[model samples]
Target: MTEENFLLSRVKRFVGSLAHCRLLGVTVVSAEPNSLCLELPYSEAIVGNPDTGVIHGGAITTLMDTACGSVVICALEDFELCPTLDLRVDYMRPARPGEPVQARAHLFRQTQSILFARCEAVQGERTVAHCSATFMRIGKDASPKAYRDYITSGTAMENS
Candidate 1:
C-alpha cells in the first residue's frame, strides 16, 4: 500500500475503536498523512430543534473536533496522548434534516509538543461549520498496549 493508503487504514481503524465515535456513528470516509474525512449519519438522536428538525450545534462541534484530533494522529509518526489545548468552532449554517454531515480536517502545523488543525463540516454542498484546534502532544506513556496497536486491532475486528 502507498503511504496515504496506510495512513487511511490506520485512521479508519483508530476512529472505529473509539466508543464516542461509535456512539456518534462517525466513520472514516478518507484519510491521509495530514488529513482525514469523516461522516456522521443523520439520526433523531442528534437533532436539537424539534420544530426545525435541525441537528444540534454540539454534535457538529464534536464531529469537527474529533476530525481534528484524528488528523493529528495521522500527522504523527507514532501514537502519542495528544489532548486538546483549544478548540474553536464557527457555525455557518444549520445542517439540513435527514442529510448526513461530512467533516474534513487538515493538519496545518506540527511541532515536538503541539499540533494545529482545521476542519470543516459540510452537508452536500452547503458548509455547516468550521473549526480550528490546537493539541498538546504529551509523550507516549502507555505501558502495555500502544494506541496504534489497539487501533490497528480494530481493523481485525472489522474483518471478523
Candidate 2:
C-alpha cells in the first residue's frame, strides 16, 4: 500500500475496534497525515427522540472527540496515548432525523506534551456541531500495548 493508504488503513482498524466505536458503529471514512473523518451510522440504538429519530447529542460528541484523537494518531510520528484535557463543542443544529453523521477533525497544533484540534460534525448538507479539543500527550510506553500491536501486526486478538 502507499504510505497514505497504509496509515489510513491502520488508523481505521485501530479506531474502529475501540469498545465505544464498536458499540456506536463508528467507522473511519478517511484519514491523512493530520486529519481524519469518521462516520456514525444512524440507528435506533442511538436515537434520542423516538418520535423524531434524532441522534443523541452525546453520540455526536463522541464522534467529534474520536475524530480528533484519531487525527492525533495520524499526526504523530509514533503512536502514543493522548487523553482529552478538554473538549468544547458548539451545536449548530440537530442532525437530520434519519441520516448518518460524519465528523472531520484537523490537528491545529502539536507540542511536546499537548495537541490541539478542531472538528465539525455534519449530516449531508447540514451542520450538526463543531468541537475544539485539547489532549495531553502521554508518552508512547504509557499506553496499553494491545492497540499498538494490533496496528503493527495487522492481526486481531481476543481481549483478555
Candidate 3:
C-alpha cells in the first residue's frame, strides 16, 4: 500500500482502540498529511462543575494530546511511535454541556527530533480551548514490537 494509505489506516485503528476515547464519543472526522480533526460528543459525566456543567479540563487535554499525536503519525507516514514531550492548554471559555466539540490540530513544523503542533477545540463558532504541544519521535529501534509486527504483517496497530 502507498504510504498515505498506510498512515490513514493506522490512524483509524488507533482511534478505535481508545476505550476512554470511545466513551467520550470521539471520532476521526478527517486526516491528511500533518493535520487531523476530531469530534467529541458532550457527556454529563465529564462535567467538572455540576452547577454550570462545564466539561473537565482533563477531558479537553486528552483530546488535544490525541490530536497532536495523530498529527505526528500522519506527517511521518509511518507506524512509528511518538510520545508527547510537552503540552500546554489554555481555556478561553467553558465548554457547556450538551454540545459537541470539534478539535483541529495543525503541525506547525518539525526540526530534528521534535514535532510542534497546535490544536483548538471549538463548539460551533466559539472557541473552547487552545493547546500547543511537542512530540518526540521514537526511533525505529525504540518502537514497540507490536507496532513493528503490525507493519510487517500489513495490519495497522490497534493501540498501545
Segments of candidate 1 deviating more than 4 angstroms: 142-146, 152-160
lDDT of 2 by residue, 1-160 (tens): 3767877987887786689999998998888888888999998888989888888899999899899888987888777878999999999999987789999899999999999999999887778899999999989889667767677556665584
Give the residue spans of candidate 2 off by over 4 A: 155-159
**Candidate 1, 26-103: lDDT as tens digits:** 998988878889999999999999999999999998899889988977888876658899999999988999999999
Strongest candidate by lDDT: 2
The ten-residue window of minimal lDDT in model 1 covers 151-160
Best by TM-score: 2
Alpha carbon lDDT of residue 16, candidate 3? Answer: 66
Cα displacement (angstroms), candidate 2, residue 89, comes to 0.9
Residues 85-127 of candidate 3: C-alpha lDDT, one tens digit per residue: 9999999999878888888999999876889999999998899
> How should the candidates be ordered by TM-score, best one leading?
2, 1, 3
Better of 1 and 2 by TM-score: 2
Q: List the residue pairs that clash in candidate 1.
A: none
